[model samples]
Target chain A: MTDVLELRDVHRTHGDGANAVQALRGVTLTVRPGELVAIMGPSGSGKSTLLNLAGGLDRPTGGEVLVEGASLGTLSHRRLSAVRRRTIGYVFQDFNLLPSLTAAENVALPLELDGKSIRAARRAALAALTEVDLADLAHRFPDEMSGGQQQRVAIARALVGERRLVLADEPTGALDSQTGEAVLRVLRERVDAGAAGLLVTHEARHAGWADRVIFLRDGVIIDSSGPLGSADDLLERTS
Target chain B: MSIRHGLLALLERGPMYGYQLRAAFEESVGGTWSLNIGQVYTTLSRLERDEFVLPLPENDGGQRPYEITGTGRAELARWFATPIERTDRPRDELAIKLALAMTTPGVDVAAVVQSQRTAGVRALQEYTRLKTRQDKQAQDDLSWLLVLDAMIFQCEAEIRWLDHCEATILRRTRTARPAEQAQTPEPHPVRKEARR
Candidate 1:
C-alpha cells in the first residue's frame, strides 16, 4: 500500500471574521497507488474543499497534505504548480474546455504549457483521445460537441499528460446513465493502468465502481470500506 | 454448485413441491443461502424440460411431486463439481441519487431525500405495529413470529439508514457544480418525469 496522497488533520475555513464557516474539520485521508477512491458526502460536508486542498488548488486553514512524500503545505506556489502540471490531472463535472479550441488542442494545452513540442503534444493528445474512443472528434470544438462528447474530451485531456494522479469531481454528473457508465469505464481503465485517482461523487453506482468509498459528514470521514466488489456491497455499506 | 444442482441435490432426498424444496435447501445449507421460491420454480421447469426431473403422476391428495431422473442425478453431480461464476452485480439507487444531486443543478436533491425519508418513516411505523402484533401472538406460532421479527429488524435498519441520509442532506449545500450543471442543464427531464 504505497500512499500517493495523504491528508492529516486537514481543515478549511471560508472566513476569519464573525461569519466564518468551517468546511473541513480535522479531516484525515489517504489514497494509494492504483486506488480509485470515491469521497461521498452531502452538500457542505467539505468534500470539494478537501479536494481543493489535496489538489493544491486551495490552501487549507490547518493540517498537512502530502503528495508523494512532499507536503503540499511546505511547497512554494511554483513547486505546487509544477506538481499540478506533472503529477496530477483534474476532471470537473463541467467539461471545462476552451470553446475556441478543438478537442485535440484542449488536450494538448497541458503538455504545451509544460514546454513539450507542439507536434509531440498533438500526437500524445490524439492518442489520449483514441483511448476514450473520441479520436474522430479531436477537431471538434466544445460547442460543436455533445455534452457526453465534451466530457470524454475532458477525460482525454486528463489522461494525456501521463499523470499518475487524477481528480474527478462528478465526472459523469452530466451524462445519462448509459453514457455515465461508459465514462466511468475510462476512469476504471486509468486505475488499471496504475494511476491513483479520487472521484468525488454522490452517486453510489459510481462509488461502487471505486476501489473504496469514504462517507463524509460535518467535515469528517465515516465508514471506510473495501474494494467494493459489487452493487450489493454498495447498498450494504450505506445501510 | 449451481442453484439448480443444489435444488436437485435437495430433491434427491425425496419428492417435494416448491415450498418444501425451499425449506430443505435452507436446512441443508444451514440457512446461509436463501433462494427465492420464484427462482426455484423457474429452475425446476428448466430441469423438467431438460429431462433431469419428471413430473410424477398427480396424486389424489392434490400435491405435485418432482422426482429426479437418472440423467438429472448425473447432471447434478457434474454441476456440483463445477463452481458457478457469479456474474450479476447489485445496483444501489440511493447512491446514484446523491451523486446526481451533487452534480445535477436546479433540481432539489434534498427534497427528494426528504420525500424518501418520510416514506421510510411511515413504513417503519407500520413495521413496528406489525411486530407488536406478532409478538403478542408468538405463543400461538413461535416460528412465524421469529420470521416476522427478522423482517421487522431489516425494515428498522433501512429506516435508520434513510434517516441518516436525510440528515446529511440537510446539513450541507454542496456548491452547485457549474460545469456539470451547464453541460447537463437539466437532469434528463425525461428520466426524472418518468420516475415521478
Candidate 2:
C-alpha cells in the first residue's frame, strides 16, 4: 500500500539550550491511503505538533516529513501553502466557521480560495454537504446549527477538494456523545472513500473510529495497538 | 459485589431517589467506592433497558425513583454466585509514556519524572482539600471519601516512585560511578578474539 504520510527521525523543538522543550524526538511514523490513525496523548504531549508537521502546517526542525514522497521541509512557504490547499484538508476542534456564511458557503471556501469559479465551488459544496446529510441545511449559518451540524459542515469542507489526507484535531471535543458518534460516522465514510485520516483525540471512544490507535507521549509514539477485529475488541483490549 | 447487583439489592428494599440510593450504598459499604452521579444514572438506564429494574411512578411530580424487579433479584443472585470474565489487561498510558521517555535520547528522564511528581503533588493536595471539606459535611458520605483516600495514597506512591526513578537516572548518568560503569561488562577474551 502506498503511504500517504511518512515521518522519519522527525524532531520539533521549542526554545534552546537548557530551556528547550523537545516536542518530537526522532519520531518515525507512517499513514497509508485509506488508513485512519488516531494519535492520543495527554496535553502538551506533542500530538498536535505531529499533526501540524504531517499536514505541512509546520516543518520539522530536523529529519524528513514526506507526503507522497514530496518532502515538506524542502517545499517553499508558497509551495507548501499551495500543497496544503490542494492536497491537505484540516478539521479543527473549534469548527472555525464564519458566522455570517451558510454551511454551503463554509464548505465552498476551500474551492473559492483555490480560485475555482463561484458556480463550480457552490455546486461541489452542495454535493459535499449532501454526503454528510446536511445539504438541506446548507443555507443555515453556523450559529443556527447544533454542534454536530457545525462539525459535519467542517468535515464536508475538508472533503471538498478531494484531498488524500485529512488531519483532524479533537474533532469531537465540542459535541455530545450521540452527536460526536454521528460526526465520526461521516469521517469513517470518508476513509472508506479512499481518503486517509489522522485524528488527534484524547477520548478513547472517538479513537475507536480509527483503524489503528497510536499512543503518543512527550513528542514520541510510545506504543501502538490496532487492526482489531471489531470496536469491542479495542474496548476490551484498552479497558 | 458487582456495582449493578449491589444497586439492585439496595433498591430491592424499596423504590428510592438517586440521592437516597447513594446514601444507602455509603452506609452499607462503609464508603469504599465513590459512585459518581453520571455512573449511577447511566447504570440505572442500562438496568431499566435490560428489564432488570424499572422506574416507579414519581410522587408529587418529582424525580423518578427506581425499584428492583423480580428479574433484577434473580440477576443479582446469579452475579453474587458467578464471577464475570476479567481477562482484560490494563494499559496504563502514563506508565507506558514514562517507559518510552526513559529510553528515548535527547529527552531528560529526570525532567519527565520531576514534572510528573509535581503534577501528582498538586493533585494530591487538591484531593486532600476536597476530602477535608467532604468530611466536615453534616451528611458525610464515607463511601466515596474512602475511594478518594485510596486515590490519594496511589498518587503519593507514584510520586515516591518517580523520585526514585529520577535519582536512579541521575546516578546512572554521573561519571565515575562504579555501578554505572560496571553495567557494561568487560568483553570475554575468547569472544572478543573471534572478531579479529
Q: Pick the candidate with the highest lDDT.
A: 2
Candidate 1's displacement at residue A182, Å, is 1.0
lDDT of each: 0.77, 0.79
Candidate 2 lDDT over A161-228, as tens digits, reads 67899999999998987698688778877887898899998765566567677767688777664543
Give one digit per residue, the lDDT tens place, for model 1 in B1-196. 4678878887789888888888887655424357789988899999999999988876797767799999999987887776655544355677687678768888776566655543443333333334444445655655444544454455446545765777756445343455446676567878898999
Q: Once superposed on the true structure, which residue ranges of model 2 sit more than 4 Å away at CA?
A: A230-239, B1-196
lDDT of 1 by residue, A71-182 (tens): 9989988899989988888999998999999999999999999999999999999999999999998998899998888998998898897788889999999799668867
Interface Cα RMSD, each model: 13.6, 14.1
Instruction: Give model 1's share of reference contacts.
Output: 0.00
Residue A121 deviation, candidate 2, in Å?
A: 0.7
lDDT of 2: 0.79
Error of 2 at B48 (Å): 25
Candidates' TM-scores? 0.59, 0.57
